[model samples]
Target chain A: QQPVQSPQAVILREGEDAVINCSSSKALYSVHWYRQKHGEAPVFLMILLKGGEQKGHDKISASFNEKKQQSSLYLTASQLSYSGTYFCGTEPGDYKLSFGAGTTVTVRA
Target chain B: NAGVTQTPKFRILKIGQSMTLQCAQDMNHNYMYWYRQDPGMGLKLIYYSVGAGITDKGEVPNGYNVSRSTTEDFPLRLELAAPSQTSVYFCASRGTGGSGEYYEQYFGPGTRLTVT
Candidate 1:
C-alpha cells in the first residue's frame, strides 16, 4: 500500500526549519527519503533500516520508527535550494518500495 | 559516465495504442525500477528488475509490462494504452550497495506521456 504523508504543502523562509512525516499502513523494513525539484528527477537523500534508526546529512535528517510504521524528514536551517517535493519510500516486503503522496516544500529568500 | 538515460522525453498516444519507454544505465547497476507519477501524487511502482532476466511486479503493475534482457537496459511496455495511464514515467537504478548499508537510486530524466 502507498504511505501517507503529512502537511501536503509547507512554506518556509530562509534559515527556517520544517518537518515532513510519512506513515505507512503496513510494516516497513526500510525507509528511503528523496527530494525532487520542478521538472527534474528525484534525488536520494538517505535510508533508514528497521531498527528505528536515524540518519542525517549536511542539514537534512530523517528518522524511521518501525514500530510506529512511520518516518520523518527534518530540514534544518532551510536554504532556497531546499525548495522541492519530499517523498518517503517504504519497503514493506519483497524489496519493493511504496512511496507516499509527497510533501511540497517551498523555501523563500 | 551517463548515470541513467531515458528516450522520448515526451509522447502522445490514443486509446489502444502501444508504445515502449526505453531506460538505460551506464553505471552497470544491478537493480532497476519503473515508476509512474501522476499529477499531485507520489510515484507508483509499475515493475522492477533485480538483475538480467529477473523481473517482478510492483504495486501498480496492471496494464503495463517490462523486460530486463540485459543489466544496462530495462524497458517498459504499454499495450492498449488508456487515458488513465497518462503520466510521467521514470526509471531508476541502484548499484550493488551503499557505503553505509543503504542503497541510493539514481533516476532518469523521465518520459512524459499524454493519452488522448
Candidate 2:
C-alpha cells in the first residue's frame, strides 16, 4: 500500500524550518526522499536504511525509525530554492518502491 | 551517461488503441521500473525488471506489459488503452547493491499520456 504523508501542504519563509513525515502501514526496509520542482522530475535527496540511520545535506536531513515504520524529513534554514513538492518512497525489501501522495512546500522570501 | 531517457514525451490515444512507452538508461543499471502518476497523486508502479530478461509485476500492472530485452532498455506496452490509463508515466533505473535496502533511482523526463 502507498505510504501516508502528513501536512499535505506547507508554506515557509526563507531561513525558516519545516518537517514532513511519512508513515507506512507495512514494514519498510528503506525510505527514499526526493524533491521535485514544478515541471521537473523528482530529484533524489537521501535514503535511510533499516538501521534507523539519519542522513543530511546542506540544511536538509532525514531520519528513519524502523520500529514505527516511519520517516521524517527535516528542513532547517530553508531557502527559496526549497520550494517544491517532497516525496517519500518506501521499499518493503523489494525491487519496487511505493511512493506517497506527496507534500507540497512553498518557501518565500 | 544520459542517465535514463523516455520517448514520446506526450501522447494522446483513443480507447482500444495500443502503444508502447520506451525507456532507456545508459548507466547500465540492473533494475528498471515504470510508474504512472495521476493528477495530485503519487506514482504507482506498473512493471519492473530486475535485469535483462527478468520482468515482474508491481502494485498496478493491469492492462500493461513490459519487456527487458537488454540492460539498457525496458519498455511498457499498453493494449486497449482506456481513459483511466491517462496519466504521466515515468521510467526509472537504479544500480545494484546498497544492501538491497535503498537504491538511488534515476528517473527519465517522463511521458505525458492522454487516453480518451
Candidate 3:
C-alpha cells in the first residue's frame, strides 16, 4: 500500500525549518527520502533502515521509527534551492518501494 | 556514464492508441523500476524488474506492461491509452547487493505522456 504524507504543502522563508512526515500502514524494513525539483527527476536524499535510526544529509535529515512505521524529513535553515516536492518511499522487505503522495515545500528568498 | 536515460520526453496519444517508453541505464544495476506521477501527485509504481528476465507487478500495474530482456534496458508498454493514464513516467535503477544496492535508486529524466 502507498504511504501517507502529511502537510500537502508548506511555504517557508530563507533559513526557516520545517518537517514532513510519512506514515505507512504496514511494517517497513527501510525508508527512503527524495527531493524533486520542477520538471526533474527525484533525487535521493537519504535512507534509514529499521531500528529506529536517523540519517542526515547536509542541512536535511530524516528519522525512521520502524515500531510506528513512520518517518520524518527535516529541512533545516531552508535554502531557496530546497523548494520542491519531498517523497518518502517505504520498503516492506520485498525490495519494492511504495511511495507517499508527497509534500510540496516552497522556500522563498 | 549516463545513470539512466528515457526516450520520448513528451508525447500525446489519442485514446485507444498504444505506445512504448524506453528506459536504459549505464550503471549496470540489477533492479529497475517504472513509475507514473500524475500532476501534483506522488509516483505510483507500475512495474519492476529484479534482473534480466525477471519482472513483477507493482502497485498500479493495470493497463501497462514491461520487459527486461537485458540488464541495461527496461521498457514500459501502454495499450489503449486513456485520459486517466496521462502522467509523467520515470524509470529507476539500483544495484543488487554491493555498493548502493537498493539503498538508493537512480532515476531517469522521465517521459510525459498525455492521452486525450
lDDT of 1 by residue, A1-109 (tens): 8899999999999999999999998988889999999899999999898898899999999999888998999999999999999999998645677889999999999
DockQ of each: 0.87, 0.88, 0.90
The weakest ten consecutive residues by lDDT in model 3 chain A span A92-101
Give the clashing residue pairs of candidate 3, or none: none
lDDT (Cα, 0-100) at A81 in candidate 3:
94
Predicted structure with the largest DockQ when compared to the true one:
3
Better of 1 and 2 by DockQ: 2
Candidate 3, chain A: TM-score?
0.98
**Candidate 1 lDDT (Cα, 0 to 1):** 0.92
Which residue segments of model 2 deviate by more than 4 Å? B98-101
After superposition, the stretches of candidate 3 with alpha carbons farther than 4 Å from their true spots are B98-101
Docking class of 3: high
Q: Best to worst by DockQ, what's the order?
A: 3, 2, 1
**Cα lDDT for residue B23, model 2?**
94
Error of 2 at B25 (Å): 0.5
lDDT of 3 at A21: 99
lDDT of 2: 0.93
**Candidate 2: tens digits of C-alpha lDDT, residues A1-109:** 9999988999999999999999999998899999988767889999899999999999999999999999999999999999999999998887678999999999999
